[model samples]
Target: MDVGLLLLSAAVLIGAVVLTATSGDRRIARLDRRLARVEQKLDAIAAGVGVELPEPELGHVKALLAEGKKIQAVRAYREATGADLKEAAQAIDQLGT
Candidate 1:
């Protein structure tokens, strides 16, 4: 009975390790794809709006987005630059990449 329990515990541990490794890889891939999309959107906005941004402002926007404050960042950008929410989000997204 003790041997059976030890085998079961070992199997469970191995399963857990495999699951953890796969999940981490999937998360990284998802983040990369998201960053790519954000970069594309940012480029489109820059071309369409013709708004030139300095480096510091871009960094702040990127930080806000990374912290998951998307709406707040968009609103702040709008208030600061008089750009609309969509435009601000695009600018912020661009900063993230």
Candidate 2:
């Protein structure tokens, strides 16, 4: 999960490609499979770290808050997000008047 580790992995993969381009060893001749594996790894990393989930709808929660019903707003947030009491309260608190 470290940025340095990710950069090192990319650098190593690039170095391998460059080495394959210049070297003549028969055993290390091709990079197609290796590149595919690197692509898969990069895809997995992106899925885990870069993907963004959409926020839950909060129109009803906002309406409740506008009506000065804080408790009902927290309950709406909980139902919308499936968050527990504390989490919903904290989230609704962040959306201050």
Candidate 3:
């Protein structure tokens, strides 16, 4: 009986973990979609203003920062936007503020 109860408890715990992880993934996906929409709107606005804006890599960098990955975010920003180290660092700093 004890063994059976232990197995059931483990199964419940596993189910909870899986549910939490999937929920988080879904939330991230939803946020990504929303960010894309916002980027499109920003691009349209920039076009209307006849101003050239930097690429949308900043949004991804900001998301990485929100996830507490400062170094990785900086690297990604540099890679995506082809900015030098100093520029990437400054961009990340601005986003953090």
Candidate 4:
């Protein structure tokens, strides 16, 4: 009886751990999908113009958008670099990296 009970408890614990791991995997998959979509949009925007943007540009864009200071960032980068709006935006992003 004791052995049987112990086996049952172990099985339950293993099942719980498996479920937790699978749930984490599912969450990671969802996040990856979301990131992919965002990257697709960014690529579309960046490639529509001449200069291709780097990773830092995307990070700066994300940060400025989050802070609701995208316009300020654009202006600052433009003044500092003499780049167009799009290029300045990319420059600000470069600063992030």
Q: Which candidate is the best by TM-score?
A: 3
Pick by lDDT: which candidate is best? 3
Compute each candidate's TM-score over C-alphas.
0.48, 0.47, 0.58, 0.48
By TM-score: ranked, best first: 3, 1, 4, 2
Task: Please provide the root mean square deviation of candidate 4 (C-alpha atoms, Å).
Answer: 10.9
Q: Write the per-residue lDDT of candidate 2 for residues 1-97, one digit (tens) a residue.
A: 6999999999999999989867856545457568769978987987889875588999999989989999999999999998889999998889853
lDDT, candidate 3, equals 0.90
Q: Per-residue lDDT tens digits of candidate 3, residues 1-97?
A: 9999999999999999999999999999999999889989998998999999565646777889999999999999999887789998998888898
Q: Which stretches of candidate 2 lie over 4 Å from their true place?
A: 1-46, 49-51
Give lDDT tens digits, candidate 1, residues 49-96: 997765435456556778999887777777767777788888877756
Q: Candidate 4: global Cα-lDDT?
A: 0.75
Candidate 2 TM-score, C-alpha based: 0.47
- Model 4: CA > 4 A from native: 48-51, 54-97
User: In order, what is each prediction's RMSD in angstroms?
Assistant: 10.6, 17.8, 10.5, 10.9
TM-score of 3: 0.58
CA displacement after TM-score superposition, residue 23 of candidate 1 (Å): 1.4
lDDT of 1 at 87: 81
